[model samples]
Target: MLTYRQTPPIPALGGIVARFSQRRCREAQRHVPAFDLPARLDRFIEFYLGEPVRVGTGAESPRAVPEVVLVAPHTRPGKRLQMLGDVDTFTIHFEPTGPHRLFGLPLQGLADHALAAPDALGTAVLRLRDRLARAPDFDARVACATAWLGERLAAARPADGLDALVAARITPGMGPAAATDNGRVALWARQLGWSERHLHRRFIERTGLPPSLHGRLLRFQSLMQAHARAPASPLTQLALEAGYFDQSHCIRDCRAFTGQPPGAFLAAWPDLGRP
Candidate 1:
């Protein structure tokens, strides 16, 4: 059986960390599909125990994913992740601006990619990984990860004030404003007292994608999440609710982002293989 649990981050790190999730599967052999959807507005820091977690499949079969990976916001689909064999992992899902806050670095390199955390973020995470492997139980592992993040959070440099505010406001589920004139980058720039060009640069540096692309992705992600919640809802209604002008626009965007139509995407949601 698969053991899964999500716990809230410590209060001190709440702004940066949305939540912490742990998943363990002890069945000798298993396949867990990590779907490639729209550009995530957030970042994920993962720690894997037991076999290393793998990404793509070889000509013959798949392999284990890396021990630690920092997944940055991606605007398109990546190779599907098939976790083969027993696995254990705890993940930190951070807010859109969380990675920059946690790592104190430009996120351009990490965007649309998952790389070895130690290579990208350095040895601090590796040390934490070792402690996680040594911890006796779930609670201990959580404690270790939290303490490690706390120290880093303290030393990490802050994001540009305007950039942080803009990112925090560009959250998911912002309604029609997101897809129409209300979602324009210039509008936000004016409101934040930043030149449009300056805002664009800051966004790319801190969040990987510019404001325009990020807003579009957020709209698509809203539709996806709503569809996931109510699979039976009419596509037209879901489209409008997610800020698409109509069902066709929604369908087009869905195919563009997921490489599948809406119905097929939802139907294949339960299976990780393909749509």
Candidate 2:
């Protein structure tokens, strides 16, 4: 058993941030708990200090990033620390960003270096949570965590077009205006200059979901994000911008993917993301 507690949120440029404290490392669950978390809530800056835990983020299942993850601090089972930030909630790290190096390689790639162990990444995470136990202020703890992540991210890939595409697919902003029903996956593919197959391949490899599904979900997110910005946003417009033909179409997609109506879901989780 473990104790899980969330600190008050600290606002960032486009997201709300928080630090979590836990007693006893939590076990990986069958699924990463699903929450219509406030879209303002982005990723986190995790600092490992004591104990140990594992984390995975995917669509109702744990999966690996087809690309690579960079772990910082040269993770050592009980010694060096671990950390990350701005992480997409849906993304699960199969590898640490660094122990000292950049380019976030996979476990197999780092088998030779020090700060390696079968459970190095996950184990180091739990240690991070433990260290938070002694944190005097939430901001202080969060600052440490954020800086670590920033450093690691700086060392990693340059947010290449592929990464940007994934981000665009994962998180999109919506306008208050209604979207046209004419939207289609092919249309988006053309806009990105990618063949449907190429886009789908990279999206699935990076995200766990296919391009079409991602587009659907993100459309929902966009509409809702727009609504959050402007309460008077026309509902029909929301659906259209999100790629639905009409409000009814948006409702159907919501029910199919989110098991709730767009209206109710939005009402239930205010400021929470469309996903």
Would you list the C-alpha lDDT of every candidate in the order shown? 0.71, 0.40
How well does each candidate superpose onto the true structure, as a TM-score? Answer: 0.85, 0.48
Candidate number with greatest lDDT? 1
Best by TM-score: 1
Which tens-of-lDDT digit does each residue in 24-58 have in candidate 2? 22332322332332212122233434323232333
Off by over 4 Å in 1: 28-39, 57-61, 159-164, 170-173, 176-183, 271-275
lDDT of 1 by residue, 1-275 (tens): 66777778888886677777777877524545554444455578889887665565223344566789888877765455555467788788877777777777688766677878888888888888889889888788878888988988777666566645655554554553353353466776788788878877877877787766666677776776777677789988888877787888778777777778878876776532111
User: Total clashes, candidate 2?
Assistant: 21
